[model samples]
Target: MYLTIPVLVLLVDLSFEKEYLSWKLLTTKVVFGQAVQLRCHLPKQNCCHNYTRSWRGGPDYTLLTLNEKSSNYTKYIEYLDTESRTSVLTIKSFSESEVDIIYQCSYGFSSYEAILQLTRHRYEFHPTESVPVSLSFNGTHMYAKISLEKVFPKPQCYGNTNEKDITKESLKVISKRNGIFYKSMIDFNYMIDPQHCFGLVTITCTVGTSRITIAEQNTSCRKNGSTFHGKHLAQRDSVASNSHDEESNIVGKVLIVLCFHFFNGL
Candidate 1:
């Protein structure tokens, strides 16, 4: 008797919903001279089908970029395919003033929005100008010191206008070692929050006619339950030491090979 095996057939159900824009609503912080890009991805091909995309400014509907128009500002928008299913909006250059406006990406019936925030200030220097600044850190604290040769009755901290407003009182003076100078010290207490996972700290210094600003970021690694310190000297020293040891080991291996070859030849 001959027996045949029956093939089992299975029906699979596959259905996809229209794509929606998923993006963070937080503002982006960028340097004055650098460029920034705002991106958005459609949920699925069905949502992008027969749909038009455009960029607008707030409720005023000020058109920044449109699929139909091509100009200097709109040049950043690139159409990827014949269906126009994928697109990217890029800012080739950024300035301090652009931080005040809000940028929005809209597709058919859905939209995503973001604002630009400048967290640091741009410094322009002249041939005769000088900026005095120093940074120091202890195990638990960080300190910034500044000295200005000239004195001003109304010294102001100048930086990105989009940042929070800073007052004159925030500038604290430590001491004046010499009669023809002035000094200021800023004390920063360091703390880690595992729950928040990430944090950003910005420091700004202003003197009689010069101003400077710095930023530091901290992030936590969940797998190891440790914080990533971008500014810690100890971490930097360890990294340097490891690199040096690796190089030394590599050199020792090369030297051993060379000595073996030399003795064999002799």
Candidate 2:
């Protein structure tokens, strides 16, 4: 009877650990300008228990959605306590602003959290040349492509100034001056433009080590004699060069140490 009791307790503990450690969200990178579903899965044994899920924006804990007090919140936000143990947060339309927020999933006794961010392509236009430039990343390097409406009198162009790590590969200029508009794409190191002052300049920036990506597009035009000359800029979305693997490793190690101390106390 004593041996059987120990075995039963061991099995129960293992079952809890398996369910507590299950993967909640499956996707690593969420694209900008799309809706996302955040899910939480409890272990089979715990799936029948009541759980609460909530989300907060940034480290400031600005509450975005909560499972409590439905009448106090907007209609777009809904709570589904479908089963006792599992809960899900459905974001109808996910935007770049929401990417940096932290999502927390909790039960009566345990909780888990993750950071959200966005990824996508970007573009920028230089008005002096009346050309549109786009940027993209190829895992290890960055590049750019330039498209033009009319052949400029000059052959060289300059990209908007950005931080150092976000440097672009050699600029590849595509001149289709004969066409009404030209299109091109290129690779470049990740960069964050801090001087984004206008509303229409399309710029995409992702937070470091977080799953947040912000994309903005802007345009400005001036009347030149009888014609209107303008520039259109779109920032492409790129993963922040910064990664959370190191932080995750540190967190995992700390959890292991806490578990050891907990068992020792027991």
Candidate 3:
């Protein structure tokens, strides 16, 4: 028998183009031990001239220039030059059991945040399951939405607004939802205490044993306070083709190999 594992294709375009600077973000859902490429492109039209670019880690961290200690980030970070129109950062392969990582790009005085999440393919042959999720934020209080894509059996979703970790009772059921690319999205306006949460503000969405988090926001009390307001987002028209299904088949074979270890007690 064959197992049909749904794939979620998110066109995450945190890649922005403005009068000063612009960047291109990675949209592919990356697997373990795979190098990911990200680019910061500067168009000659309205971009700031001679703007120095640097990469930083986490929702809260000084410029990468201050790092004297060695970590995973240093091993993965590549070169950046102001003379070139584009700066490429090629992240080295990550371990399957490794935790999720966030990367921030800064140019001049503007900063953009993006997080890279790790995923595991759950086989239906087993009694357990997993939910595929994507987490993102707009910095603004508006459009602070959490997307629960590629959920099997239409799993129930609960959201909680917390600092660091989610609380048990804060996760309220998210009812207002829409479907996209053969998947589902849940949108809500859960308020955030800007001053209290600060760089630690987060929203955790729970679906059974799986959960996704929205973090590294630069919210403050002076700007929007605790009012998290946002309009509903529409679904995308472009549907994924047969290529993704073929990719699933490749992942299935890898899953079989992983399961073999469990049975053999490796």
lDDT of 3 by residue, 177-238 (tens): 22211134545443444555444344444433445543233434454433433211111212
lDDT by residue for model 1 over 1-266, one digit each (tens)?
12322222111111122235643322254333445555656556555546777766533437767773534553344343435344565655544345546777767666777664432232211112244233344433334444443332223342121243323323344434332223333443333233442223345555324555532323223432333454466789999999999999999999999999999999
Candidates ranked by lDDT = 1, 3, 2
| TM-score for each candidate, following the candidate numbering | 0.34, 0.34, 0.29
Query: lDDT of each structure?
Result: 0.46, 0.42, 0.45
lDDT by residue (tens digit), candidate 2, 148-201: 332212223333333322223333344443332233232233333223322232
Candidate 2 lDDT trough over 10 residues, lowest sum: 229-238
lDDT over C-alpha atoms for residue 104 of model 2: 66
Q: Which regions of candidate 1 are displaced past 4 Å?
A: 1-19, 24-29, 45-49, 58-61, 73-76, 79-86, 117-266
Residue 163, model 2, lDDT = 33
Q: lDDT score, residue 94, model 3?
A: 38
lDDT score for candidate 3 against the true structure: 0.45
